[model samples]
Target: MAVEIDTSAFTEEAYELLSELEDSLLELEERPTDIELISRVFRAMHTIKGSGAMFGFDEVAKFTHEVETVFDMARSGTLPVTKALIDLTLAARDQIRSILDASRGGPPADQDNANRIISGLRALAPQKGGAAATETKAAAAPKADAEGPHVYRVRFEPKPEIFSSGTNPLLLLNELRDMGQCRVVAITNTLPSLEELDPERCYTHWEIFLTTTQGENAIRDVFIFVEDDCTLNVRLLTREEEQEDAEPKKLGEILLERGDINEEALGKALTPLGDRLVNAGVVSADKVRAALTEQRVVQEQKQQQTKAAEVDAVVRVPSTKLDKLVNLVGELVTVQARLNQISGRLNNQHLQLVAEEIERLTGELRDNTMSIRMLAIGSTFNKFKRLVRDLSTELGKQMELTTAGADTELDKTVIDQLNDPLVHIIRNSIDHGIEKPEVRKAIGKPLVGQIHLSAVHSGTSVLIQVKDDGKGLDAQLLRRKAVEKGLLSPDAVLTDQEAFMLIFGAGFSTAEKITNVSGRGVGMDVVRKSIESLRGTIDVQSELGKGTTITLKLPLTLAIIEGLLVGVNHDYFVLPLAAVEECVELSPKDIANSHGRRIVNVRGEIVPFIRIRERFAMDGERPIIEQIVIANVDGRRVGFGVDTVVGQHQTVIKNLGGSFQYSDEFSGATILGDGTVALLLDLARMVRYVEMQETKETGGA
Candidate 1:
């Protein structure tokens, strides 16, 4: 079969590598002296350059080569890693991304940016420097001399599909030639019939004799990117001490040197048995030495093949395909639930056994599919490092962002939608929550502010908190702003927590002046809407003179939920199981003692309750005995009044119709096994509405 060469595959791999490259650059800035990080940065750039040239991204390859050269100098310790070098490298990284985009017809790269970076790099790391280049070359030569010069016989044979990956075998040969003296002979015996030839497949291999003062490590570095893409072998023909005086011998030495002697033994033997044993196994010294050299090259090649056979390889699958598999698993879950219900009602032993087996299989399948979709949230968090760095510089603030719980995992879909909302929240923290350096110093706080972002798994959800150590929100000022905007009555009294929440209201802003970053009042409002759309909740906690923490609670996945199915006067509803804390009985005496307030006293804790029937305007007679489901809402325990609890359900949530989509009381509706539609309540919205009503009633009293 012909090689399936897809340009999109190359682009996808390039994008993933670029993200890693950006991450490495940011890390290198923090630890400039780390050798491993330096190596990582160099390798990333070299791969991008080589792969770009192979796939027709000529401009990308050309621009990246210059960046690679800078890092190469860094790896050799010829050029010190400085802040200016880091900045220019970052700019070059962005320019490469622009080139990739332009290659695929997104837009042309910024020529000014490319030129500015190239100019900066050239100014700093030039080929011919007056004193620095001389010092560097003099410095690097000894490091090589310490290892001693050796002749290496390298055989490079790329897979037939190497062209598809954008690699040119000739380019690799050219790199070998640059290392020192290299003789290359291309073998075209693998060439196929013209009728059967594949244009993209490589049909040639090369045998190379490289005489380099650089040692074996240097030769291996040339083929690092193609480690898995080709067959490579580099064998040493001389030792350190011998190579001190052992440059390649004349043709006469080639025909007379003995093969049995190791380099150490040969050093002394070369002077004595100079013409005794030319080759080990053949009669003619010239032809035998040639054959034995080929034998060692092939032997080293076999060792590499043997080593490669032991490794387990993983293939990359497209995310779209994984998404399809998840959807299929969801449907299977629904069908399995239906089978369970039927088997329970029929009471047939055989049918019941089959249903149990199907349930077990379905559960395992669902778990496996979920595991595939789960990705560590750290990747998302790492991207914000650059954001914080750039913003801190732009705003002229001394602040550090500390993070924790990076290993927490979330659904890919949820993480994708979370980026913009999180950006808005973080920007707000920097602009409004964190005080300036002078202001902070005047208030006896540290000169540099601290912004801490943390994520942790809570029940079936993940809680992400973005906390800042700066000026806390002034509750009084927020109340005043709410009154001016008509969001609250002037006489309305609110708890500190309630007052802090007013920032999420539309057109709410306490900023005295507008700036480019966060003062326009469009941020928090949209943040609330976006979080609510994901069936999540956001809450704020602050002190008078201390810092503020904003917490977001979101489900691990959006498609399926573990729900508590309930019935209120025959209308069904589903409550997220993560939110449910307990179930309690609502007594008549408790209601009478509260004097018209809907509440319950549970183990010395008075929790406010809301009747689902009244909230939805469902017409039903009050049941004498009722069940109250206690849940944690906004960090407080609240209760929901329902008629009966119908056990747990694996709810496959579906979107609401267009007319009902605007309503905030319910997030979405789920289909039940019996074909009944259960509306999934947005508990946060209902709790907020309930609190507002109680505040008004208490004010009247």
Candidate 2:
């Protein structure tokens, strides 16, 4: 069977074809050697070529033919699907899209890029197999099919405002003749008299007869671009059929023939049938009622099915939309709380019930909407496997990436923001944390280096870690670098943990030489800034030559938070509940035993702690029996001493605005039900404050 191809149809159809080509190229990375994938790619190219020749996209067909030949060899099992081949085909697929894009009056295709892709395709051609001969045969088949002569009659009526629409009827008429033999005859029956004629309106139509073997569809397609607004018809007539007089069937007659509806049923349905059916006994009253009810139910079911299908077909929306929706829900929740307060005071049962119902619905909606934005971090983690493979190959090292706790889910927006920081950390681990294979082997370690990236939910926060089994950070070198960068004093007394964190200081690099991977002293500072901006914390743990683990503790979502409110100087402050470990009371005797040190003795172990009042620089004297709220920050136990612990709250975190933006101690502010704003503590910034205070005290001593 032969199909008539229209150049007008090619514009849209070619775009779809090239999009499929690009999708196939992306799929190849996952299933490079799958024969089905290779065959599907081949068939898509083949279809593009066949349809291109039938239409006028000859350049697209010619360029795709060479790429298709390379895949054909791979299909025949003569050439393997190597990474180089996949990359080459990916580049060629892009070129094919560029060529098709240009056909639609887009920017011109770059010849240099086209030549580069062509060279890549040529490199994949089989050396011994008759692939070239096979390809030549496929290219010749279309030429032979383009050889017959046929006749077509065309009728065209341009719309009354065709000239006003900026369409040139003359250009369309010329395009029709370019295909084959053509004739044109104009009909002036609708043209107005000279006094009534309007030059802006098109009043004439055309009837033309052309002889070409392109088939009826081709003739019809020539007018497809104008078919919606203009009257167009095409027919093929032979000498035998011309002897008889016949007219084409109308659209209504065709629908009737197709059994879509009957005239008798339509007439009966159009009448006032409710009272008539009851009186005629053609349908009993009960039976008629039952039928109507059944029909209504069926219609409802169909509507529900359609809605479900539409929902299923919807593409995944960006998390920003969900975030906005959640914000709206939060406002609704606040309003609902206000209504509940009013209803409680009014003692009206109906209003109370309505308020209760609204509260339940608002809560459920908030949860369901937030769940929609939640996604498994595994998708983000899987990408690191490919990264490790490529980077290890480039660095001439043997490194294996292992992941765990991938089932952990976080807000989609958080995952998107997490990708870049995670990538930088992973790169740093591979380049600097994991030693070279030779060095590892000389030290009697395994030849293969291992990097583990794992995440787990800790209360409301997700804890992720990138750990590597290689030489850990050299504290002495880091200290010297920190001193040289002026981030620390030359005579600064520091613990090993404090020294290691200096790597995150700006302008500090311990790498002896700058390499392509990550030795410019840029990535670690970015990692720190990004994590801090997300209200997250990062901690580094290392042993001289064993390994290092960098842990990141991030909130599940930045919009809403689970908080523990505490009263400091009669003002409420919100502390993330995930970070609250345990609360302990500080007595004057217990403070006296510590000798002014921040360390507190808790259950026979020394856990360093900080007082919230002191950290915030409150002026009031300390409480006699101070309550120390101990929490774990980056695996280190720290305590915040407050006056009293107010209860748990679901706080909607709002930015502190430009006025309070400079204060790192407070991440955001949340309004309590009583219209009071409670500041949310920044645990990461608090820890940094404690570290800085310790450094200053040691220097003074």
Candidate 3:
């Protein structure tokens, strides 16, 4: 039976098989002598070669044959899977991919490189097998079939474009002859006359006869590539039958003659036998399901593992889907807000009951949708291992990366934007923060440096910190650099915190020398910008000669916020509830004793304070008996005086666009139930700014 080959499908299948082979090779890197891994690699290449010839990918077949022979030597224990061999094979695998990729249009592969790789591969082949004996066996193996040796007759007719596919039929015929007792007869009955012939089109077919102990399935395997495009019939023929000049039994004929199954039932069963076999474990259940699901897919194609193909499959869906879902829930929340407003306005029993029920359901729905986009930050953090390992090796430093709270989950969007900033901080710690081994030894420190990346939930925010047990930032050097860069006045008095913040200023790197990794004077500033863009804040704390720690505090999600709404001069402003420690009622005596300075005594600690009306530039007069909202930012307590506390609200955050981009006090805007827009306060930035002002005044005194 002549089977027509589809070159495109053949190439695709070859690539997939080779990819699996490469994966196996990679896995074997750690355990080179793993017999199972070696066998798998061999099987993968064998299948590629077998199917390649069947589909007219003769170049692939010929190339892979030599590679497989080398592995065979290793399989037989005549050669070991050395590190050099693995490296060479890895290179060869990459070359194979290049050949497959270039098959469509690129020039012929570099035979010199191919020959070189093959030579390396061949170096591993056993020399114990004398050349004369090997050649004698190779020549005589095809003629030795007798007795009950399995015989298979395969007829293949490739597509008319086979010739242009860079495949020669003679190569496949020769390959089959090398396998076992084989005879190939080309059939040109369909060829056009010389006057009408089109040379580009394939006008030849082949009927192949093979006798071997190799199973009937193995013979059919030779035709796997062209099975769909051509007709194929494989059966058993005994040596006695061949000598008696009897034709090979067709599959249907054997089934009928053997009385194993009836013709009518066999016809029906053949269609579903593959599915039944797959269900019974002869084939994978996934394959059976895929075939049942996609009827148009060929049986040979479906026979391959579905999971293998799907392993790398990814589908890109539009973000509009997520946005629409979020918007609908947002609207529902607004409606619930209106209901709550109505329930409060009218104490009607029925209305209040309905409002309570709707509120419960709406809250649950919002949480569920938000949870859908939450992902653990560990995946983003794990890539640093490779980075740290490479840098430590290059710099001749011993370093270990310790991560904690890897299960800490945050909004996917937040984590996505956080990757680059985190990389910068990690690189800084590895390149500049971590001291060299010799320096550390001189300082009585351990030879190895320790870099820790940790994340944890702090109220409604996620705090990620990178700390290293190495030389910390030099505050004095930072201050000197600040003055030199004209970032600070020459005689400016500075606190430790103020000096540390200078690293975040653009072009303010303190590294004495520049290397490929750091000291470019651009990293920390970028980290600051990225964190701030997410409505987050970063703090740097370092102990000289000990280590430096950079912490980024970010919201749990960007979409909604839990805020403490406060009244400032009849205007409502919301502060993130995560930052609020407690609220206090300011007494007249307490207000009078402050002496116009924004500092309040809470317990035994003196906490800095900021008047809300002054900070937000509100116009109305201040109210008596002011309410104070105490917030903690970067381990410092700061108090904000408001007219009244309006209680907590789940506010949906809205971006304040370009107009309010520079407004450090308000992070965003949110809509109230009464259709009023309240600006959301960025408590961290507000507290920092107030503390800076306070530091300047104290320094002046």
What would the per-residue lDDT of candidate 1 be over residues 579-680, giving only the tens digit for each residue? Answer: 899998877777788899788889998888899999888997877878999998877899999999888888877889999967888888887777778999
Winner of 1 and 3 under TM-score: 1
lDDT tens per residue, model 3, 59-153: 77887877776666565445688877776776677677777778788766777888888777665554535433333333332222323245455
What is the per-residue lDDT of model 2 for residues 1-701, given as tens digits with 9 covering 90 to 100?
98765565665666666666665655675687665576667777777788887777788788877777777666555567887887777677667778777876889988898778877667565553344654654343222113234455566788998886678888888867755556666666567899999999998777666654346765666677777769887755332223123343332232244233345543454235545544644443443343333334333434544565576586645456777898898777667767877899989999999999998998888788778888899878876776787788788889888889999999877898899899988998888878888899899999999999999998788899999998998888888888877877777778899898987877677777888877688888888888888988888999889999999988888877778889988688999998888888889999999999887899998988878888778878777988888887767788888998877777888888899968988989887766778999987678877787886787641
Q: Which pairs clash (backbone N, Cα, C closer than 3 Å) in model 2?
A: 150-212
Task: List per-prediction Cα lDDT, in the order shown.
Answer: 0.79, 0.74, 0.73
Off by over 4 Å in 2: 1-33, 36-69, 76-78, 89-114, 127-314, 340-356, 444-448, 584-609, 619-627, 698-701
What is the C-alpha local distance difference test score of candidate 3? 0.73
In model 3, which runs have C-alpha deviations exceeding 4 angstroms? Answer: 1-320, 393-396, 437-448, 603-605, 692-701
> Against the true structure, candidate 2 has what lDDT?
0.74
Report, for all candidates in order, the number of backbone clashes. Answer: 1, 1, 6
**Better by lDDT, candidate 3 or 1:** 1
Rank ordering of all candidates by lDDT, starting from the highest: 1, 2, 3
User: TM-score per candidate, in order?
Assistant: 0.73, 0.62, 0.59
* Candidate 3 residue pairs in clash (backbone atoms < 3 Å): 1-155, 2-155, 2-156, 3-156, 3-157, 142-181
Residue 31 of model 2 has an lDDT of 82
